[model samples]
Target: MAAEKSLHEYDVILVGAGISGINFAYRLQERNPELSFCILEGRHELGGTWSLFKYPGIRSDSDLYTFGFPWRPWEEQNSIAQGARIINYMKESAAMYGIDKKIQYHHQVNNANYSTSSKRWTLDVTANGSEQRAFRCKFFLMCTGYYDYKEPLKAIIPGIEDFEGTVAHPQFWPEDMDYTDKNVVIVGSGATAITLLPNLAPKASHVTILQRSPSYVMSQPSEDKLELLIRRMTWWSKPLEHRLIRWKWLLVPFLFTRFAYTFPKTCRKLFGKAIQAQLPPTLPRDPHFNPSYDPFEQRVCFCPDGDFYECLRSGKGSVQTGVIEKVTPHGIKLTSGDELHPDIIVTATGLKVRFAGGMKLSIDDKPYNVAEKFIWKGVMLEDLPNAAFVIGYVDASWTLGADATAQLMCRMMKQMRKEHVVEVVPRRSEAEKRTMTEEPLLRLTSTYVRKAKDMLPKAGSSGQWKARSYYYKDIWMAWFGDIRSGLEWVRGV
Candidate 1:
């Protein structure tokens, strides 16, 4: 048996040392000097997804210009960054903030139980489960992330169990699995498969990507002149530097939304013109990539590495439009009666989501599950008090949103402390209101806004929680919105 260690407690417990957790800890420490924190990370290292994915062309889907911390923006001058650089960025963040000590590595959380009577939580965790440790904290932030865990996939067709030369998920790619000269079949088209197609096509004999349906893809120069000019600005006030870049790209949308009510046609034309410029008419082929939906509907795919285009031009890559019929011993059979022999198959499928660290939450033991609840102020949950989780725009720079969330969380915590309120929960609604309000929130002008209502933490049908998707409006909201207006309080016992 391993030697027993002393128990510990803290004012706040953050799970996962990834972008969200690390940022939260940093902001919390800065905002509240007296509060104690302990961060529990399952992985041995700092970078979460960045460390986990080692596939050939692994990288961030969003441009690092705004995706990284506001104070430490990516000055690499590339819109889309490689997996390695992202990991390095995380390391720099940990070191710069002195967050290493707060992180208890190899501590995998099994279950965390909350006790409202005591207004604290007991986190039952084990490292490799050979030994266990218990930690108590007044507040818990679930930064395990919506996509931390990998999804399970079956052949869906017959005979996949035996004939497969090599099959794996992109998240769990083996270290020694050689793809050189091997025919590789990558399934799915979300971000992972799109990334793998270009990276693997060169090394492998050939790469065939199977897409159930078409997703919009945009190709930009991997390195742009504008990006080169930005790196020199990183050491300066980084947030201001990042904010300038964010506002620059954000202007077209801002103008469109700001005057859209009065000048819808002109605003629309400006955006349309921008799109037309990028996909110049001189080039042939359908502009499915241009997308019929308005911007920010589903987040646009970013492939600045130019690998996607390079592979297609070289004829080493093929992007098929359709679903899979089944996986044969040797290869995949498409619905179109096409059979592609692949030496290896990778399922880059989507993720399954749960709420609040996937932990069973109880407020005074009322049994809280945030998955189905309405969000308030894009942070707090209804029927739960003294609690909130980070859920940002799935289509934008996630860390940008996360940074704002960390700052907002600090403010909320301060309110709780100042008022001596022990808890804050949202009021439940009747069945008459089953979906989001038809009138969209001002900040959330994106049509993709509709896609996340099930999970977004909105402030209310109005107020900050009303659910706005516009970045500027949210920047305004996060900075100036009356965050405490909707907070229903419970007196401490």
Candidate 2:
């Protein structure tokens, strides 16, 4: 007979150990100190994207004040921080809260089975790509982020194999590789490509950013002047100064989004002027800086202190806009019949967005398709019992949504324990389903989001069933609102 598998039990199983995971764990332990919880990390270490991505000039696209957790004030002067600093910050947060001790590294959850009868989840986790283990938990919280770990969204160009040059993806950048004096061409005009231009240009023989279409690009200082001023004020306490700076930075993004949506033409003019002001007089602002879509429709790329533009102006970098016809032994050939030669090509293409960390989910041995379900307030899925997944905002800093979701999850779990309930599920009535409209979970117009829309959950038309992206609205609903909305509390099964 085969040996029986040992099952470890816990009150909650928090997935990923990234920013969302650490934040959620911190909130749970802070609110309910007696609750037993463990964090499951797929990778050997923490830091999520910050740790995973080691590409040139990898940094948070959003300002650090908003990107950092609300509980922890970012003391760094640079609003746009390097990847290593962010990773250390996350490590420090985990260590300070004792969250690192609770993390089980290399424990990647492959499948989760929920039993309605027992009101428990049986997780099949693979330890370091082998050695399967079983973990039973009363509540499951998935903070695996929005993208796939193993695969990135790489475009299949014709004759890609014909290229003799070194090709790489930004997602899994080779650590030992060096491009000190080699000519480099980075594909895709998204955040990665934009960031790589300035950083690589200084060292590389020449750096060229090739894109099929343009994306909105703006420049801002690395440091926040207002935060610097606040920090310098000796009369103000550190905590008070931090809170004020955080709120101030938070309002900027919110207002920017509001203005863009409310007055598209006006915002477009303002954005166009900003781009033109940054670029040199020789570089035409038409096709290079001006994007096809309106502002805020897609994410705007930020270049700290016009670093990208400075590289271009200084003749160290260039931008090319054309469709890729094929890749030659020398370099890339454009559809417009323009041939360019480069020593190295980097595919800075977008991520492959995956929901629930691509883990197979089943309810009582029946396979459950999460895409068919409706999202409840962007946290819980309709009719999904004792589980919540973090889906952050596309418009603003992701941590804002993450913090809100964590607060809500803690509140709901506490309410369940207080009421002596074994299960708390957000179920939509048949009438509610018929009356409510369905929409994609993510509203962003980015390529990655568009590709993954079919695989993600849907949002309802109104009430608690709808998923919201606004941080201000979420603050009220998740932080201070009642947990009874659209949730069913049941006694012991």
Candidate 3:
């Protein structure tokens, strides 16, 4: 007979050890200390995205002030931080809070099933390599982020197999591979491609960014002088100074996002002028710098202190706007009769969206289809019991949204215990469902988001079902908003 699998029990089971997971862990410890929980991480180590992405010049586009957790202020002088530094910060924070000890690395949750009768979640997880383990919990939290780690979004580059040169994806950048003096061409105009241009340009013989369309690229300083001055003020306490600086970053981006949405034309002109000022005079701002879409329609890419533009000025890097006709053995041929001869090709295309870490979810024997469900206040999913997932903002710092979700999750858990409730789920009445039209969960019109539209959860027109992006609104909702709007609470199992 086969050996029986050992079952471990907990009050809550959190998946993934990324920023969202760590923040949630901290909040849980602070607010719901009585409840027992452990984080199940699939990788050998923590740091999720920061740890996984090993690409050259891997850094955050958002300033560290907002990106860093609210509980722990990023003390570094620079706002935009390198991946290694970010990883170190996360590791240090985890260790400081004793959250690292709660993490069980190499535990990949394959499937999760909720029993309505028992009011518990049973997860089928693979520990280490092939050892099977069972973990049961009252609550399940997925912090796996929105994208797939195993596979990147496959770009449709014709004749890619025919290319004789090396092709690399930013998601899994080869560590030992050297690009020394080889010509490189990076595909896609997203943040990843924009970041790679300046980073690879210095060492490569030449680096060219090949994009079918343009995106808004803005330059900001890595370190804020005003923030530095504020830090020097002896009158203000350390925490007070940090709070003030954080608020400045938070409000500035919030206002700017609203402004972009409200006045697209004005923002466009401002962005165009800024781009023209940094770029070389000879380079035309029309085809390469000009985007058909309005500002923040898609995410605006940021380069610290005009590094991307500086590379262009130095002639070490350049941008080409055209459709890829095909990939030759030697290089890429464009539809516009232009050809790029590069020794290395980097497909910085995009990431593939994977909900709940691509784990199979079910309720009592029925399969849970995420695409058919509507998100509740961007936290819980409709009909998904005692569970929540964290999704961050596309326009602002991701930590702001993650922290809001964490606070809301902790509050809900506390309320559940206070009210003596065994289970809670977001429920939509049939009447309400009839009036609600489905919208995309992700607000962005980017290629990856568009491709995964049908695969993601649905959003409602308004009320508790709308997919939220504004950090101020989300934080307020977490702290003071009513949690019982559409949520159903059960007294006993």
Candidate 1: tens digits of C-alpha lDDT, residues 122-228: 77788754567888777777777654354433335445676558987887788898899998878776677878888888789998777665455666676556545
Best by TM-score: 3
Query: Which digits, one per residue and each the tens of the lDDT, describe model 2 over residues 1-493?
Result: 1113568799999999898999999999888777899999999899999989999889889988889988788987778999999999999989988999999999989899999888899998888787888899999999999899899986888887889989989999999879999999998999899899999988899999999999988898876677677778834587877787788888987998999999999999999998888787778888887888889788888888889899989989989999999998998999999988999999988999898789999999899898898988899887889999997888888898999999988888887888789998988877887898987677778888888877888888887877686999898887788678688989774
TM-score of each: 0.82, 0.97, 0.98
Residue 234's lDDT in candidate 1 = 60
Instruction: State the TM-score for model 3.
Output: 0.98
Off by over 4 Å in 1: 1-7, 148-159, 227-243, 246-296, 428-465, 491-493
lDDT of 3 by residue, 1-73 (tens): 1223488899999999999999999999999999999999999999999999999999998999999989899
Clashing residue pairs, candidate 2? 383-426
Output the lDDT of residue 332, model 1: 78
